[model samples]
Every structure is written in structure tokens, then in C-alpha cells.
Target: MSEVTTPAMRARPKRYLYIAVLIGLLSFLAYGATYPSMQAEAAPGTQASLEVDVDLTEWELNPSQFDFQQGDTVLFNITNSGRFSHNLEVSNTAQHLNSPTIGAGETTTLEVTLDNSGTYTIICAIPGHSDLGMTGELTVSGDNPAPAEGEFLGIPAMRLSPRNNTAVVGSSQEVRVTLHDFTLNADSIEGANVGGEGHWALFLDDELIASLGEPSYTLEGLSAGPHVIRAELRNNDGSAVEPALSSEATIQVPAAAP
Candidate 1:
């Protein structure tokens, strides 16, 4: 028993010290990586409504334009102190459009985010919208804000031109859109087979006019009025379904210019 040497007495103390040090290091890194973004994430969704006056003729906006890091959360407030039957739209330069009715005198807040690290365009879709200074953009970079998910829903991106928000009906208008690529595994998006592609259907708020399942598609012979176009997708199972990534485009198809 003399060889026992009581080595356990020395080893136990050192092991306990090492464990304590390791835990401290991990805790520090965890906090450091998440703190900044958690602070930047503006309250859950878009901002709340605002009170505006009806007598004013001009308006002001909090952020005419914005740029954010991947994990950053942006907060936006809309102020419309102008006299007109108008609203504000937000989008990226890549053609994401939004149109909110401010109704001569109203104010509100909205939000958009980039879960992907890329450049984007935001615009107001009211007729003659962007041209009337109703548009702005938000550029994002680095690791984006993804939806706590690890899957793709087979949905592709949709876009129109800067001047596409307003068009003249019964006129030869250029209808263009682009669909990007996405990857899906484990079939979490429904009827998803595997190695299937994505496509889009253009509508005039009533009828289906074109099917753009490729990179880009255009619709001709369009009549004028207020029109809203949507791009939906089909899964690997060849089912007409709404992908998690559907986008809507609005244009004022003015009563065929007389």
C-alpha cells in the first residue's frame, strides 16, 4: 500500500480547477457573440401606427435609406403629414415593393429584413410611386437573419422594374421577373420530391397570364387598371403550392392612356 502515494489528493484539486476555467470561457464567448445583435433586433415585427395631420402638404421620413449587417434588426417609422390620397412603400433596389395607404393624412410603421446576405431594392407600388419619391432601399451583408430554419420551401424570388410599378393598360408593357435558385432536403416543404425546379405565375389580380418557371419571364398584351402580380411555386411533387418565398408586385395599370 505504500505505492498508493496519495496521488488522488493532488489530481482531484487540479481537475476541479480546469473544469471551472473551461465553463467560464464558454460562457464569455456565448454572451459576446449574441449580445450586440440581440440589442439591435428592433421589437418583434414592424413599428406601431402613428398620428399624422391632414392639413400638411409635404412629408418627412425617419430613414430615407438604410444599410444593415446580417444579424441586425431595423426599425422604421412612417410619417405622412401631407395632403394627398397617398401612402408610402418600402423596398430594396432589386425590386421588392410595398404600398401602404396613408390616406391624405395618416402615419404608420413597417419593417423588412434580409435573411440572406445580399443587396435589395424597396419601392412604393402606388402609381407613379418611386418617381414621386415614394421609395427607399436597405442593403444587408454578412450572416443574415434566417428564420430559425434549416430548409428551403422551393419558393424563388420575384421582381419588377423601377418604373414597372405604374403602367398604361392595353399598351405594350415590358413585364419582367427573375427567379433565383434554392436547395431543399428532407422534404419539409410538402409534396417535394427531389431535384425539382421552381416557377412563377403572373396574374392581373384576376387571371393567370404567364408561367415563368425559368430564370425570367415576361407578360405582354396587358390591359390597364390597378394590377397585382404574384409568383407562386410548385414542389418536386409537381403540385401548385405557395412556397415559403412568395412575392407580390403591384402596378397601376392606368385606364388605357387615351
Candidate 2:
């Protein structure tokens, strides 16, 4: 016996087919929206955009620390969300890509390549900006090249201790400097290097404060605020080294009582 065909049966099959197609289309749309972000996170050197957000008033940076791989080309978009203009610079390393001074609420794009692999300090070079805590760090993954013999003018090295930027208000910030392959001598011994004898100059906010034969100095008479301390290896005649071998640290003094 032949079975009778019903319109309802045909309509139900169509309904299920339509529902399956709808779900497939929705899944494709969702994947398309999320795929780019996933790809960026998984691939370190992929073509992507990295953002650095800065707030001068609060002296804070978003994503204050980031990781980079050697040979990676990244587009950095630095945004100044504060009320003042600011610029960013990388210090204590040979890698040299920077953003210009960006005005308040303005954004700047900087394309940079990570050629060297090492820990780098990121700071705003606006004199007192770094003192207010506008700083961060970048950790790059790869091998950093070493200088060959005679490639350097002198055996020059420096270090700053108590590197963190916190200190008591109205008190002297004591900084210690360590030198390697370089000598600290008195003014009587300043000028050309004889037996590697030289001296060091202490700078506060880029201003030369004192020339010392010893490595320790007290930063005194500073108001309660952030300050940048720098130590430069100099020739006996008070001449700066070629390209300047130096080390720096930032200290923040707590506000004193009224």
C-alpha cells in the first residue's frame, strides 16, 4: 500500500535545515571576529599593534611591562591620556626607537624593530617626567651581542643600586655606583687615561652636580618629589666619553607634612 504524503512532514524537514544553516552562519561570524586577536596573541612577531597608555597625573602606564622577541617588528601606538604632553625613550640599551612628544589626548605611532635582546628601561625624557614615575620595562628574548676587544674606547661599565624609585620625604637619597674596567681618580688625575685612571660626574635631572673620585654620593636638599640620578664616566679633563657610558636611577620622595 502506498503511503500518503503530508505537507506538514515536508515543512518540518525544511524547518530543521533552515535552523542548521542559521547556526552555521552565526558560528562563522563569531570566529571571524575573534580570530585576529587569537592569532596576535599566539604569534609574537606577527603583524600587530601594541598600545601603551600613559597618565602623567597618576604617573602610571598601562601594561607597564611587556615581552618582545628579537627581530620582531612591532607597531607601537602610544597614547597620552593625561593633561600634559609626553614622549617616550628607551634607556640603558642600544635599541633606539622612540615616540615624539604627544600632546594631551593625542596618540602617536612608532614602528620599531627589536634588534637587541635584553632588559630595557622605558622612560619619558621630559626632564621631570621620569621623576614622577613615568617609567616601565621591556624584556626582550634573544642573545645580545658583546663588544669585541678594542671596539670600546675604554673598559667602561656602571651600575646603580636601590634601583626602585621610593624614598622618604625631606631625606637624602643615597645612591651607590659601581664601575668596571674604569677608574675613579681625583681632579689632579683628570684628562687622558693613564693606566685607565678617570673620574665620574653625578648628574641630577641631567645637570652635572658634582665630580667625585669615590662612587657614593648623597642627593640632598631635594624637595619631596621624583628625581633622576645619573652617573657618567668621564675623562680626567672632565670630558665626557664618546657616546657616554652612564647609569641612572629614579627616586621618588614622599610628600612632607604641611
Index of the highest-TM-score prediction: 1
lDDT of 2 at 215: 80
C-alpha lDDT (0 to 100) for residue 163 of candidate 1: 37
Candidate 1 local lDDT, 59-88, one digit each (tens)? 333345566665444444555665654445
**Model 2: per-residue Cα lDDT at residue 151:** 47
| TM-score of each candidate structure, all chains considered together | 0.44, 0.42
True lDDT of residue 4, candidate 2? 84
Residue range 1-258, candidate 2, lDDT tens digits: 999889998799899999999999999999999999887675644544454444433475665687877666666667888887676666443443456666678887767666677776777655467788888887878886433323444556666643544343466877677665666778544556664567888888889898988888887878777888888877788887665787776777777777
List where candidate 2 sits over 4 angstroms from the true fold. 1-57, 93-98, 109-112, 125-133, 145-184, 187-192, 195-234, 237-258
CA lDDT of every candidate: 0.52, 0.69
> Which residue ranges in model 1 land beyond 4 Å of their true spot?
1-73, 79-108, 113-155, 159-172, 182-196, 214-224, 235-238, 241-245, 256-258
Give the Cα-based TM-score of candidate 2 against the true structure.
0.42
